[model samples]
Target chain A: MTRIKSDEPTGWFMIFPALAFVGTLILYPAVNSFTLSLHRIYMGLPALGEPFVGIDNYLHLLQDPVARQAFGVTFGFVILSTILEIILGLGIALVIHEHFKGRGWVRAAVLVPWAIPTVVASQMWRFIFNDQYGLANLVLFGDQVSLYVPWLAYPGYAFLAIVFADVWKTASFAGLLILAGLQVIPEDCYDAARIDGANAWQRFWHVTLPLLKPALLTALLFRTIDAFRVFDLVFVMTQGGPGDATQVIQFYGYKTLFTEGQVGYGTSISMAVFATIFILSLFYIRTVGSSLLKRETI
Target chain B: MRYTSKQAWLLGGILLSVMGSLFPFFWFVITSIKSQVRVEAIPPTWFPDWNFSFYQTVFTDHHFLRYIGNSLMVAGSTTVVALILGVPAAYALVRVRMAGKVWILGGLLTVSMFPQIVIVGPVWQMLSTMGGLNTHWGLVLPYVGLTLPLAIWILATFFKELPTELEEAARVDGCTTVQTMLKVMAPLAAPGIFTAAILTFIYAWNEFFLALLLLTDPVKQTLPVGIALFQGEFTMPWGEIAAASVLATLPLVVIVLVFQKGIVSGLSAGAVKS
Candidate 1:
């Protein structure tokens, strides 16, 4: 009763079509982005007529105020959102760790936000925050604070609004990943903690927290990286409005290339994004890559 | 060891967390049904008189139906293409370990991470040149490219985990490679395929940037683009937008609920464990 005789060459041919498809879509786009980032172009009537300008675009971009501010906002959003998500995510995962009825339903319901598209969620929340008819303003501030404050219209609140939406949509993602980590902990460690008279908090702190490190780190890595690339939500919510408050690095990069028709400059902005993500990913890979890899594979 | 005070605290934490999570959704649903004045009223109304006016308006006011149909077509087509292309690729990577496979996989991951803006320029030019702009195929082609790598990796990992004996037996019984894949392996890998389908559907459904860049015609717009067009200065009818968003999300929500297992497995499977 043997199965799948190892006829490897046929298998190779079968996968080649997919390889070519990805190459055109993914690989080429990535490389193309870098190439354009290095070139300078002139925005004309319709088509972009351009000449080459090597690192000039990047050098100018490095000193660009708009680009720098977007970078700052992006860093702030990613760091803040990742921290909140991990904390809240871990808290939720711990609670679900208990034996309870309707737990499955609860878990599924919590994931609803995570599953919804960012655009939909952002729009939903944007409407909710609408100063005139928004639920948030009506409920939280009311007409007393002047419902005309336009939550998305103000810079600070705009950034806050985007973060709020992101946190709502993604915290469950952190929870699920952390929950998977919780499942992997050996039952005996908790049993030992109980026998030692450790309180619930003590047991969690000394036992669960350490055990869940890999999952925590993994969630952090994914969420943080995603935060840096945050575009759709912000794009939909504010389009980096109210004087560039909500604008993140990605949005700025995109505008430079597409909206402004500065291909070279836009590419540089994107290159900066790539470089930013690359550095952050390196630190993550260096720190928890091995541990996360082991846990995931095994 | 036995259950103690810690268990009670744990339960309390769970309750609070659940409340935190479910409140916004509850709020959104309630708000969606409320009148504009009630929705905008101070201290907010927790409950609303049931009204379908917003839904009615959303349906009548914009090209909601067209947008939804576009979404379905694009998502459905992408799912079909991703499955056709990704399944075999995944199998090949798993079974053959073909040369440059690692590079191929790496390339896929990079694209998945590639911001939509970067490629939209060239892709738009390419699609327009091919006369695909604003058509369903333009969106579908990019989606297939976007999702195939992920689908392949996920399916390949699942395929790798299957017992090799079933396929070997089929081969010994004179089943050709395609026959073995179709008859023997496909059935066994149903769960993984479901995961891939659900995932592909989600990406296609939620996709915004490419849809925004490529599909410019309001009548031909996808759901995301259609909703975005509703955003305007002077007035953005909250009730209408909410209604449309709720409607747009209904299919996705239903899909997520019905395919909860597949959703989770798809997300986790696509990510790691290779």
Candidate 2:
């Protein structure tokens, strides 16, 4: 606010607490995780001793079929969930963006799921999909007791159950993001499209879509990054169960690190997770930075 | 006719979206209120019998109130610390001339994008080493760290948007920077700070991963961790778990309902900004 080239010491002083907290807790530990990844350490077998085993854990991660399956699952989960969220989110954004009575209430309604804790949402879905007396079964089979699907027990359905829960929870978030994007588009663009004899779908496809690209990309990137680190859903709903079908990478890391106490191997998985997100965020930053730079030049 | 059909389609979509968003939590709330027999009924009770027995049981038997208190303390402190740190950092990042400002923000962006798995291992170890495990401060320590990036981002955008006149006038009044900041800018930035605090509070309240790792003792665990682990202690504490979930999530739901606009703006601004 003060355009007056104020003293820089106060700037540093004001900023120290946040920097200190992040540095000590996040940046330092992140680096520590890297160093920890280099050594082979087991919590249960301390006598085996902490041995420096460079790249062995990485190699082990590569060979482990469970890790492979986890990645594959993570890949599927990200793709399916992000696609569904974007589609549903677009529908939501389009609907809410229109001038409607009680729009605030509707928007708030959309945010309810986003507001609930992931653990809570996961439990809610688990109950919803419960085989015995679950809402899913009751709604589907009614009094007929035989057809209750053990949704989380079956591998294919189990995966879908988590994805469905995810979509239910987060579609609203994407919707809000897209709505923010939608609010910025000039009304004249649509008016012009209508003047050119463009029908609703045609105008949406031609004009609305192209302009909404950045927003869609923003939503997509955020969703993708979040979906990559999905742990609470898998942990609560499925626990990567019924043949490890839902074992996303983060859950795998958790089990290995905390459950099994293989700290070194676990940290490698953590590194992989970090690397994947890092690369993704770099791509996002490039696109975002280029746009900002473009604005600067203009 | 075409216009009416379009409006109908819009209405249909709007109804579907709202129901889809609200139905799951609404179901949980209903379940939380259902009697034990009614909860287990095959044809699940469509309407609650207005039973809050499960709520009574959880608070009494499961010490659910402790978890809630723990969550409140952790989330509250996390919000305070995040804002205390974030507001000035954001102010500096926005207003003050600092070198390597771009890199600091770039680093903040990277931190925001970081998956918890990346930092969980060492954070766990560090907490364990410091005997911070199972302590509220232990959990708050990392919570503050993880939330700072988004807090700063949101606050920076808010600070950038404030009109310059008040700040300029304060400066011209010969008030020192700190005095002007504390007395002037902060009150003006209250709305932004509140938004940031709400977002941070909700995040810390709902954060399960670090809490799960750092706070293992039942007495020390926050609400999310408690709710997540609610099932293991009983054969099928569905009713109780539902009750706990409802209890755990009620504050957040209220937060969303009341400050929906602020939360949405903060989230989108943080996500979309530099």
Candidate 3:
């Protein structure tokens, strides 16, 4: 807690080993990806045979229709899912903000889906959404449920299925964040609102919402960033299949690298993801990061 | 305090939401034990036949024990390595004000963010060259990279929250930095360390894509990847798959339940703060 001179060396020597691990493992691969993106590939020694062909991959990515569609889906997925999670999270957080009986159990239960492995949840929901034997149609549509609606086998429905699972799993995450926000709100404000005869809705709008902004933004940014790079559930559930309808940029990048063996091409897609996310962080930094740092410190 | 009808309705809605959330796992357990005939039946059996046979089949044929062992090894190794490496880095970053903390954090976060597919190719190539492919180390090392940055950040936050006077006093007493860290700081921050360890373990244990790509040997694969092999491209072994899944997930479920507060706190730490 001591305030020292700003110029004083904090003796950060201890961090170098950890820093080195990240630099070598993560940054090197990321930089390698960027380098690969700029190079042309030929199958040869070291596997990623290359001569530098600057910006070709980027240009090709820009022009490729499939890549474009995947980009659209990625954007759609991030924006739509993040927005929905935030809204629902805020609503649910408000409902659970106060003290109640069995609150601890309810709180733990809400996190169960979040704790489950992404692949397991995907498989579970896959069967549930199965047109033939799945419970979704049965529960939602009664015995007259048709056995032909392939949830993962179709294009649009496949996308819907991915989004449904993502939202269902993560909205509670948003809720948890907002609940933390709610917990931090001083109770006196609510007491004051009641003394002023504010209705529940009015109190929420005037009191809770304003106080919850930082946490809301934190949850939104976290969800936004996470959603942008989503790969697991989609990969396991559909493998970007049914003619790549559910394919997002991440999966597309993955396919290019691993499945096609076009290292350079895959690297280009990967770099694009890195750059896009970096840009997002910058944008988030401009708006919410400061507030987050301030609030977290307090 | 008095209850209004509106408040009561809100409580009901919240309760219903929580119940709806838990309904899937309820179904998962019920279905896992159901007979394959019942599992595939049109109407869907609401309750399982109370048969231990599915559990028997899973443990007997599927190398279920090996998968659990692999999971424990990968997850356990990941937890240990990340803590050993991350705690010092976190201390240095927060206490020493490390020069590249931001870039390091950024890079680590990026790795965490990138889909496993993006790096799996190059990583596979690299590991194969090192003869790590199909080894537990292959998965464990990547799992460390996967969890390290977040663990460092979480611990850094805890470190920052810590009052530095004790460390200062230890230093003034001629205690070395390592000694101060071990003697004064580590014990005080046990909860934070536990939080990091548990979360890292869960993440590594639950990880599928990396395990799938690197560990191609059926006998060598971890539980998640092992479970995937049971359901081939041609055939769907419903009973066996469900049973394996139930077993694969039990450790995580148990850990989450036992350390619910720590896990939740860590997740909230990540989500609500950064």
Candidate 4:
């Protein structure tokens, strides 16, 4: 095979346009956010210029009760949603992997929630959870029941509603990825396992689980990061309401920056989010190693 | 071939899952057509009095059509821009065999994962300073950046699978690198381009946070932000909101149905890999 001569200049030239756009649009804003977090800039009318305040923003975050509550809400949301998505997604993936009539239609149906925008999905759920005219009360209680519980108006129920919505929207995404992984496994392995007198549970534990690790990790990683940074759904559904019951970090940052005009403080929250996501990604990559990036056969 | 208990269980589970996945959308469609009186009625009207008044209100009173135009313009532009920049970069990563390629790919993936909130503050400030706020281009610029990483990843996977002999043949036939890439390689990679375009357009269309922040002017808002902020002065208009939600989601549903195979492969490529 005749090797194309490795031309560094040509490679650099070809890559320049993408690098330039990414650098200006993504990298610069990221660096600017980091810099702004260290300053005291008020976005209020008659804008006060940024002044270097170094770590004060971080300290303020530590003392802010609302911020602390947001962190807790975010943690719970991420953990609960990710776990639920994994279990539900795995079951769906396993079922869809079977040879069934109308399987193609089922797969397409599953992608609908994921296909719809988060805002729309949240609105759909909000209507269902409405206190007065909501389907939840009408159906769960008698049709004539006057007593109603506004699900989104209370803290605990509001939080549960958000979790329920998140899981419903994303579990199919997890299922699709895991289904792709399931498709790649050789049928002969299962045949061989059955020949060796292995039961269904034993085969799944030994063969399926081991081979499915990469896909499982990939699904978990994407879902965790996404759940942590959730904004549009929560924003549209509750606006982190019921006295900051469901405020996640992203929503907190939005309020600080856009609503309160505290640029420095908002950037601090944003920076914290970035750091947390970076650490999580590093953990996944380190544990799963390079195989996460390997191209899987369809 | 008698049906066994296990097969029955599996079939039942599949049926339940399908219903669970699709019921929300069915409800959404039903809500869109309900009358205001019915929408607010207690013992929520299971069977709505067939009414299209909310749809009329959304189209005529709210200027919902303009929001759809804005969304289409932004998402369409973002898809085009991301592809133009991403294709060459993906080609280089695949065929150039550059050093530190793995790190470069990893860095791009990390950028895709950057929480939008982190970037929104700086991006807002930059656009404000440049007098780009409340404009279509302002939103399109950031969306291009956000969608580029995924586009490049998907395109790169496709490019990597292309045989090098095609490139070599084009080169030997007196084609420059640019000519070979544009004339020979791109045509062969059509399916990949289609996949990338669909996904990129969806992301831009569905994005809400930045749209809410930058396009505060009602006329400039996209569908997601527009429908979200459509709360009435005295009361929440569930009927109008539901009608508008259906309209906003219609384009995506159409896309999913028509291009299910491409969308599925594209999603798997971005998530799992090839």
Q: Model 4: per-residue lDDT, tens digit, B1-274?
A: 3358769878887887888888876776777788888888777777878899999999898898999999999999999999999998998888775688888888899898888888887788889999989999999999998899999999998887788898898888888777878999999999999999999999999999889998989888999998888878789988888899888888888888887778777788766662
Judged by DockQ cut-offs, is candidate 3 incorrect, acceptable, medium or high? medium
Residue A52 of model 2 has an lDDT of 96
- Estimate candidate 4's alpha-carbon lDDT, on a 0 to 1 scale: 0.87
Per residue, candidate 1 scores C-alpha lDDT tens digits across B18-93 of: 7766676666677668787766565556678787788777777676788889899999999999999888878767
Q: Candidate 3 chain A: worst 10 consecutive residues by lDDT?
A: A3-12
Off by over 4 Å in 3: A3-10, A42-49, A145-148, A290-298, B97-118, B232-234, B270-274
| DockQ metric for all predictions | 0.52, 0.76, 0.49, 0.68
* Residues A170-250, model 2: lDDT tens digits: 999998888888887789989999999999899999988877777788898889999999999998888899889999999
Order of candidate numbers by lDDT, starting with the best: 2, 4, 1, 3
> What is residue A189's positional error in candidate 4, in angstroms?
1.8
Candidate 3 structure lDDT: 0.76
| Interface RMSD score of each model | 2.7, 1.4, 2.9, 1.8
Clashing pairs in 2: none
- Reported per model, the fraction of native interface contacts reproduced equals 0.46, 0.78, 0.40, 0.69
Clashing pairs in 1: A2-B168, A2-B169, A3-B165, A3-B167, A3-B168, A3-B169, A4-B167, A4-B168, A37-A267
Question: How would you encode candidate 2's per-residue C-alpha lDDT over B1-274 as one tens digit per residue?
Answer: 8799999999999899988988878888899999989988876768999988998999889898899899999999999888888888998888888798888997998888788888888888888889898899998998999999989988888888888788778888887778777888889888888999998998998999999988888889888898888764636889999999888878887888899889878877866554
Q: What is the C-alpha lDDT profile of model 1 across A1-298, one tens digit per residue?
A: 2224456788777877887887786667667777777767744543545667778887898789888899999999998889989998888777776678877666767777887777878878887777665667666665465545678888888888888999888998888778777877999988999899997779989988877887788788778878888888888888889788988988887787668877678777877887777677668756676776565564
Instruction: Show where candidate 4 strays beyond 4 Å.
Output: A1-6, A45-48, A290-298, B1-3
lDDT of 4 at B241: 88
- lDDT of model 1, residue B103: 72
